[model samples]
Target: MRKYLILGILLLGSMFSYANVSIRSMETELVAVGISHESIKEAENILNIALKKHRIMLIELEQKELEVNKLLIEDPEKNWFQINRLLDEIGQINANIKKNQLKAQIDVRKFISKDDFLKAIELHQMNLGVIK
Candidate 1:
């Protein structure tokens, strides 16, 4: 259980960080790659909407985690039902996060070429501290 919690936190952190960086630098990188202004605007709008949803989900996820931790600390055996429910809620939130991410990707792809989109992603990854 502890390991799963740690892994979930790691995944969420990495994913949100990537999204944050993409929104931060997408315009400049896209422009550098010769993406048109209208396309860049459309892509950014998609990302912004997704990012807002992600932010809310992240907060809710953290709150649920806290609730689960509290239950475990107070009484694992007695709180089994509540803990399991929270776990399910967490799973649903994760699923929604992935869905939102995929939707954002699809929406952005509608207006941006594959190469330019990939370049933006690569740049965002670099911003996230990739070696090069």
Candidate 2:
């Protein structure tokens, strides 16, 4: 009984670990591609309808993982073969999202150049009566 309980805990932990690792990897990839938080936020807001779109995509990915889990349990013999394919497709989608996110970030960075950022700060100060 103890052995079974330990195995169950390990399995549950692994599932969460896999999901977290996938998300972290994607985030790292986006950061490595020179994407910034501000740019990603802007892209999520403007390029997509809103941040909700990104959330929906993440939820869909999680749903696909759940489907994979169900398939594995319901018909391991038949579904086992397809698991790799599904995972591959999911990975590709993640990569695509990362690429698109990086592109959007780059576009946002271009739209707001260094000088523009400085000017915007100055303008804000002027509006706040901090500067003449």
Candidate 3:
């Protein structure tokens, strides 16, 4: 369990590092593809706000997950109820993160053109090597 938690933390750390790069790459690609300055700025503002909120939620989620792991390691039998409660909180945070991401995407789509938005997505995937 400890090993799993350490691995999860490492994976999440790497993902967060990649997320920062990905956001900047997307912004640069949007400009390179001739997306309007106004649209880019608007989309960037929306995304930044969402990203800020997401970072908070992710930190909370990570802390709660760590707490649960601690409880489990210390005394799974004695801390059963607390462990379950923390697990529930983690689930709720995960759900909220998903909802927040969807809302941000919808908000961004309103400010950016469909074609431009798709182009940015394609460029992002290409950067990740997800597309040939």
lDDT of each: 0.79, 0.53, 0.74
Candidate 1 is scored at a TM of 0.71
Report the Cα lDDT for residue 85, model 1.
99
**Candidate 1 vs candidate 2: which has greater lDDT?**
1
Off by over 4 Å in 1: 1-34, 118-132
Per-residue lDDT of 79-111 in model 3, one digit per residue for the tens? 999998998998798788778777877887776
What is the TM-score of each predicted model, taking all chains together?
0.71, 0.47, 0.67
Ranking by lDDT: 1, 3, 2
lDDT of 3 at 108: 72
Instruction: Kindly list the per-residue Cα lDDT of model 2 for residues 26-76, writing each as its tens digit.
Output: 443344445565654553344443233445555665666777778888897
Q: How many angstroms is residue 72 displaced in model 3 relative to the true structure, after the best TM-score fit?
A: 1.1
Best by lDDT: 1
Q: How close to the true structure is residue 132 of candidate 2, measured as C-alpha lDDT?
A: 94
Best by TM-score: 1
Q: What TM-score does candidate 3 get on C-alpha atoms?
A: 0.67
Give the TM-score (vs. native) of candidate 2.
0.47
TM-score-best of 1 and 2: 1
